[model samples]
Target: MCDECNQYFAKKIEKRVLEMPYFRDVRHRNFIESKKRRIPVSKGIIGGAVDLKKRKDFGTEVIVNSPDIFQKILNGEVKHMIIPVNDQPIEDNKLISRFIAKIAIESAAQTFSSKKGWNNFIINTPEFKELRYYARFGDKLDMWNYSQRRIYNETDRFLNPKVSDGPYEVLHEQNLVFLRDRELYFVLVLFGIEYVISITNPKIDGYKSWLIENNNKCPIIEKNERDTIKGERYF
Candidate 1:
């Protein structure tokens, strides 16, 4: 992307996504620090919420959001403050779709860099026109739909026998999968929440169909090329 477009994405799309209630909390849980190396705080209020911060020098610190709430707690008048957990199943579809589109196209460009002429093909292809326009310009479409689901808990650990640490957390994971319909979908997992987007078009029915056919299997797991219909994009 050009400098101007990069700045636009950084300020408008990426920042908003990072500070989103769910993503921010996930970042906090996975210790995914920002470019400035500061972890975010949660702001989800679905079940009410509290403010707290982790301290390297000490224990968890309760960063009060409201003086009134703090005073109430001090006076023993507070009942409870539920720390934010679990956002709405979906939020900010348009912004997120653009974000996904931006990353998808970028990833494809990078993936195709050594393939000779593929990067130019990606730039010129009409199949990605909507995604490119929407991601960079932000006015091509009102909203683009994607599929989101929690395949695991935010803090869940996976065991890897080869690793000395034993069970370890997955901060994030991503991959591309080709479906039988010849559509490519980008799957990204952040703190165990998986977000999938169809790159050839705005719809995600291809991914949904894949799940239904596979008995609701998580798409992030590597699949044999035979598992995909003539798969070449599963790398």
Candidate 2:
């Protein structure tokens, strides 16, 4: 990577990290602090499923607003759930939701694996392949859109270069691809839970236990309030 390319990638990463909803959140800051001090932080997992029913209550589990679920996840609510996809039905909504969820999970796993220095963590697993299939192919098993194709191509080029030339450019393109895919995955997951599923509530205790068991492998952050900047919450 040339100096200019390295600088560009660094800037892009910094900008994206700053743009994250949790960027200035207290809990996230604390997590970073704890990591720096070599203190162990308890990790939790946040997952979503499609539910089609609308109920008055969610029992002991608090019902978080659907739009705020992602923020809640960022805040570290290790176990969170969103209700049915939406008020109206759409064709193949269930299948779409499942596909989006898979993509989000896979992308998250990839991010974590890269950060934790695990090159082969979930990327090469059967589960990963299954999820990738869903992401790469829609309900009809057709190819993904051009954006997705571009991401895949960029990823390939970044990971395997024919020669050592344009290293920085390849790396930059890879990061851009990741950012685009991550955004798309989140959008799909949110849409799926908002409209398609039939369940009314989530099993919090079960999710927590699962998180505890998988903490070593997948650490989760705790939820915190989003910081206000100039009277507007970072979305």
lDDT of each: 0.70, 0.31
How many clashes in each structure? 0, 22
Candidate 1 residues 1-235, lDDT tens each?
7999999999999999777776776566556678987877654221234565656553556666766766777887766655645543355477788888888888878778889798679878887776788788765556767888866666556654554345565667887778757888888877556888888777777788888999887766744312211212101
lDDT of predicted model 2: 0.31
Q: Which ranges of candidate 1 are over 4 A from the true structure?
A: 43-50, 65-67, 87-92, 162-165, 223-235
The residue-by-residue lDDT of candidate 2 on 65-152, one tens digit each, is 4556557667776454432211122334333344333445444565566566454644565544554544434344532222111111
TM-score of each: 0.83, 0.24
For candidate 1, give the lDDT of residue 147. 85
